[model samples]
Structure formats: C-alpha cells, structure tokens
Target: MATSSDRHRIRFTVHYDGRSFHGWQVQPDQRTAQGELERVLAKLTNGPCAVIGSGRTDRGVHATGQVAAADVPLRWSPHALRRAMNALLPDDVWVADAEMAPPFFHPRYDATSRSYIYRLGLASEADSPFRAPWCWPLLRPVDLLAMERAAERIVGDHSFKAFAKAGQEERGDRCTVTEARWAPWEGIGLEFHVSANRFLHHMVRYLVGTLVDIGLGQREPEEMDRLLAGEEGLETSPPAPAEGLFLTAVTYPADAGTKPPRRRGPQLVP
Candidate 1:
C-alpha cells in the first residue's frame, strides 16, 4: 500500500485504441486519455494530480507503449495502484503495471527514441474484424516495391520541411530518423515502422500518406529524393488518417528503468 510521503513519482505504460477517443492530451469538454487518467489518479490520491506524457499523440492515434509520469503524495504499491485504477477506470483503459522511479526521472525528457507503426491494408472479404480499427482500409492494390524504395529515401538525418504539416510548432522541420522501413503485413496489408529522436505533429502520417501515393503509382519513388533536397511547392498528397497510427515504443537509458504502471487496453471514463 502507498502511504503519504511514500507516494513518489510513478510512471505508466498506457495503451489505447484511437478510434473512439479524441486524442492523448487533455482538453476541455473532450474525453482524452490524460483526462481520464488524471481523474483516476486524483481519486486514488484523494487530491488533484497531473501526468506528463512522453509526447502528444494526435486525435484518433493509438499507442501501445505510450509513457507518462505522475507524482502522488501517497505511497501506494504498484499492484494496489493497478487494481484500484482498474476498478475505477472504464473498460476502454486499464493499468498494465506500476513501479517506482528516481525523483529526477521524467518520461518525456529522458526518452532516447520513440517508434511508431502505421498499418495500410486493402479492404478484402477475408480481413479480420478485430484489425479494422488499427489498419487503414484501402480499396486499391499498392505497389510494395515502390513503397519500399521511397521509404529508403527517408532514412537518415535531413530537414524534413517538405514532409511536415504546415503550422506545426517546432524550431524547424529537421529530424534524425534512424530507422524507416516498410513491409508486408501477413499478406493482408503494409506496415511502416519508424524510429526517431522526436517527431513533429502529423509527421508520420504525412510521410505515410506520401509513400502510399508512391505505392499507388501516383508519384515516382525518386521524387522522394527531390523532396528531401528541399523541394518547395511540389504538391504532395495529404497525410493519411490518424486512425492507422500507433506509438509502439519508447526507449530510454538503462539506468532510467523505473517502470511505470501498465494498461493493457483502452480505458473509458464516465
């Protein structure tokens, strides 16, 4: 059980299905994961509390390893916290695990890398019903080779200004993408996985959208190279929808292994 003063900083691994919720961040008059999380934490602590997420995920974006941290005044055991939160939270969300962390540890700042996966699949009669929310349903067949070629062009450090969504808040559109690849998803669809130090708003979706165009033969794969070389006003396709995206994982230094509570599924708030 957590007692007052032993209620130290705790981290959480939260997962959600982005189809129903507005987004990960809390907003007024909207049902967000953060808002529901804070509500449960406040009830447990008997006071108001706030949690800081590793990053903001856009509306309709899912997360399998979304990290968040919060400070509580009571020292509640990880199991106890998980159980209590599960009892109070809705079925859409639940705590996966709970662990203590160093006082200096922060989920957002200490993260070294963040990875995301996007699913693109053609709608077929044999598709699984469970995967509908996580995979984009495309009516046309796509050229897997073209997508792979275009994906290679995005691997490496570069000023991604051409791919970034306009009006995103950032110093600039530069990002170091250490890994970017596309692969077939069990003969049903395509999957894109990318890892980066950080990402701008709608960056992955925009990139996926452009690559999908390449796969559809709407654009040549080599055009990606030109786009990376600071091409301006070349008219790219709109970004893919957010529903197919998921924050898959976040890596940190080994020393910062203070585990947070984990939630297996999305939690709905009343």
Candidate 2:
C-alpha cells in the first residue's frame, strides 16, 4: 500500500533552452523536457519515475518559470533531490527551485493561470546571433498603438477558437485572459505579455501573428474582435515563430500558489 513513507511529492521550478528540446511532453524516442526529467529521476531512484509539467510547450518554445511535479523515494528530500538533479541534468535544462508538495498535487490541473512572453526585434541589431534565436527580427517598426488596441480585445473571457489549433474542440476553447499587453523589450525590440486561465494549442502564437499584421497595417485592429466572435471565413494569421515564445510562469490558488515574479523588462535569454 502507498504511504507517506513510501514516496514524497516534490514541486520543481524549471527553466530550459527550448532550442535543445523537442518540446515539454514525452514521446517515443524523442528528447523532451519530461523525458529528460524522467530519465534522470529513474537513474536516481533505480526505477521509472514520471514528471508532470504545468503544460506542454511546443518545440522551440523556451521557459523561465515552468512548474512540474514528481514523486521520489522518501530518502530524497526536496533540497537533496534538487541538488542531485542539477548535478546530473544537462546544461540547457535547469532546476531553479524545488519544494515539498502535497501528494495529490497535479501541476497542470491545479494551475489557475499561465503566462507567456513573445519577443519581436524591431531593430537591425536584433539580427545578432545572440538575440536572433530568441526573437523574431522583423527589423522594421510596428504600430505599437494598433497592437495594443488589438491586445485589449483579448483581456477578458472569450472563445478563442479562431486563435487555436483545431481538433481540441471537445475541451472547448474559451479562455479567461486576465492580462495582455505590449512592453518595450531590452531596447532591442517589443515583447508581449499575456496571462490567462488556460490556453489552447498555438493560441498565443496565433494572437501574436494576427496582432503583428494589424501593427504592420496589413489588417485592421477590429479584426481581433471579429476573430473572437468567430466570424465565418475569418481565420487567424499564421502562428508566430515558436523560437520567440517563452512560458514565463504558472499560477495556482492561494494555498498552493506560486505567484509570478514582478513584471520587468524582458531579460536576455541565458
């Protein structure tokens, strides 16, 4: 029978360079965030262990505050486990912090919201190798006001079907977005910050793509509203490059919560 003495749950705050991973979810023969964690954990425990993440980030999508949970043998305290994992983990994946969690903790289901940041390079300097991999180097000015207006339209509850990948309709596409805004990035570009109760596949990317079009004057800002309303024949713009997206944080209820860090200017990708 399972008992507290048998295994303990640990919550982990992780960061990773998405360029090196296939994605967050584990797949047969694919290198993924979860797969790496499980592999390391299995070696530590001398058996299989599963790691559950707050959500699945697509390929080439980075993360600074991704949360995950897993069960480890009772001998491995949170601190020791974290230290051990870091010692064995690869350079691109890191365990920023680890703590005790209730045995019932489930990162994905317990999360109250998730936040993402998408970076865009509006200047020629952004083309530098160091920055280009982390942002879309458009090398042109965009109408910030137009993008802001379009973002405002998504700041409340809405059916985001048009902005998501199809085939998940059974779960519905309604998302309650609490915040969405554009901010100046580290003097090189613009960044979009968005927080929501839930996100559908490619929702943020589609939103960014569509908003970028509006900012570029290729579409009207009002089109955001039309997409939310699911106007017939109206489709979202192509998804933005996955390289520019980052899973910034995940939030949960007060007792189980990990509040997001103070909002700041976008930081350089490590």
Highest TM-score model number: 2
Q: Please, what's the RMSD in Å of model 1?
A: 5.6
lDDT of 2 by residue, 1-270 (tens): 112567877899999989978999988988898789888999999988878899999999999999998878889999999999999999989999999876556687778999999999998889999999999898988999999999999999999999989888998989999999999999999999999999999999999999999999999999999999999999988999999999999998755524333333211110
Which digits, one per residue and each the tens of the lDDT, describe model 1 over residues 75-183? 6766677788889887777667777766656677678899999988775832567776677888578888898899998888887877777886455878899999986
lDDT of 1 at 39: 92
Index of the highest-lDDT prediction: 2
Candidate 2's error at 187, in angstroms? 0.4
lDDT per model vs. reference? 0.79, 0.88
